[model samples]
Target chain A: MKSRLRVLRAERGWSQADLAERIGVSRQAVNALETDKHDPSLGLAFRIAAVFDRAVEEIFDNPHRTEGPG
Target chain B: MNPFTTGPASREYQLATAGWFTLYGVILFTVAWAVDGRGLAAPWVYPAAVAPALPIAGFLWTVLRFMDRSDEYVRAVLGKTYVIAVHLTLLLCVAWGFLEVYAGFRHLALFWVFPVFWVAVAVTGRFIRTTR
Candidate 1:
């Protein structure tokens, strides 16, 4: 799943490691999310959204979306 | 804190596992020493052989506890690694069994199973990281 994690993290001026620590995961995991190499679970998506103060949908684009708003 | 392999909880997990394995090795060697030159017909032989399983069970429990305490992503990484290791170990062991039976290869000791699995995990993990 593609994500705007790097953009949001950049807006916050937080490095990958800083964002990772806030979300309680390794920087590699955060990198995986940012690079679309790994899809976050629902819980992790929520945690990421919580860290960024945004909705989960705002951070992760649902790869399955067909009729929904992009 | 490096959650993958090093943290307070991770340290606890390693130390506990190490301690249990030490006990397991000690029990196995002591039993072997006691039974040396003695026939397996003795009543105590079977029980002595089975005694090492106690520490092994403890070791497994310690692993479960480590998984229980790890963060979600770390647990996921470990879970996938273990699954890969399990399948790889089974595949290789089965292939080796066929060769041992049909091609006259030497049989491996049963005690090498866990070590073989760990080796597979390390190889698979490295492959994943390097490919990434």
Candidate 2:
């Protein structure tokens, strides 16, 4: 799963630590998420989206998983 | 009062960091006693032996306070490890009981139970945090 968290956070001029503190997680976790080293669970995704005031889908997208051919 | 409501990692890190202070005390005490050969005569020996335990207890309390808020995955991992520890403890206890019953062994050391429980919790916590 790839996410726009980095871009979103950057747009808001927020450092990873700032975002992590706002989201109630360790800064390392935020770094892991931004680097695609870790995938956020649904709850975490929702929280991230809430922090950005954006839809979860806008922040997260599963590119590798494709829909079946019609 | 509650570490979990504040921050889990922060509390864990704080307690672990403070544990080093107790470790220092233990090391200093051990060295003094070993070098002087005055373990009994040293008036500080008793306090030195027991002082570190106070910080250790505080560390344990902080860890427990935060651990109670572990996620489901954490809880499951810990629960599994604890189950294994419980089984191991039961096996040891039963073996001792059998020995006492049939082999006429008077008693078995009972101190291993604490290590068994400690190892289970320690390993489980490490596993959950580091697991991919």
Candidate 3:
């Protein structure tokens, strides 16, 4: 999943650590989300979206057209 | 406040994980010693090792029992670490079994493997947090 987490966090002048603390996850998880290397779970996605006061769809995007293998 | 011990109802989850750790350690030592010294078949060792699944199930049951309204960052991180370590440990142990049993190689010992895996998990988890 691709996410606008970094952009949203930056708009609020928050460091990755700051955002992570607010959302109750590690800074690396936030960094991974920003880099699109990891996809947050639904609960985490909701938490991130809540922190930015945006809908989950607005923050996260499915970059791939086809789903990968299980 | 430490949610693990004092905050809300999550202390039960913490205690359960600790209990699982104890069970895992005890079962591993007993099974390892029994299978190594005695005349038990190597295949029987598999069933003994699977005993840890009981504790793991108990731990997860506790986690589900007290799903708090607020997230616990520490628990989430530790839980992820535990999961990743378990996966890597299982993979390495299986690979070692195949190499030693099937291919006639017995280079790695259990003592070294256990400590290496424990340290690797800690180092990897810390690296994930500390890297700039």
Candidate of highest DockQ = 1
In model 3, the runs with Cα more than 4 Å from the true position are: A62-70, B1-113, B116-132
> What is candidate 3's lDDT per residue for A1-70, written digit by digit as tens?
7677888888999998799789886555676678765667789889888899988878887565356323
Q: DockQ order of candidates, best first?
A: 1, 3, 2
TM-score of each: 0.82, 0.46, 0.44
Off by over 4 Å in 1: A26-28, A67-70, B1-3, B37-41, B129-132
How high is the lDDT of residue B72 in model 3?
A: 43
* Residue A17's lDDT in candidate 3: 78
- Predicted candidate 1 versus true structure: per-residue lDDT over A3-57, tens digit per residue: 8999999998999889988998777677777876567888989999998898898
The models' CA-based lDDT, in order, is: 0.77, 0.63, 0.66
Please give, for residues A1-70, the per-residue lDDT of candidate 2 as tens digits: 6788899999999998799878866665676677665677789888888999988878888665486222
lDDT value, residue B77 of candidate 3:
49
RMSD to native for every prediction? 3.2, 8.8, 9.0
Best by TM-score: 1
Tens digit of per-residue lDDT, candidate 2, span B8-119: 6555655674675567567657756754775454675666555534554654565565446554233333455556666766877788789999999888556455555556
Candidate topping lDDT: 1
Shares of reference contacts reproduced by the candidates, in order, are 0.11, 0.00, 0.04
- Give the CAPRI rating of model 1: acceptable
Lowest lDDT block of 10, candidate 1 chain A: A61-70
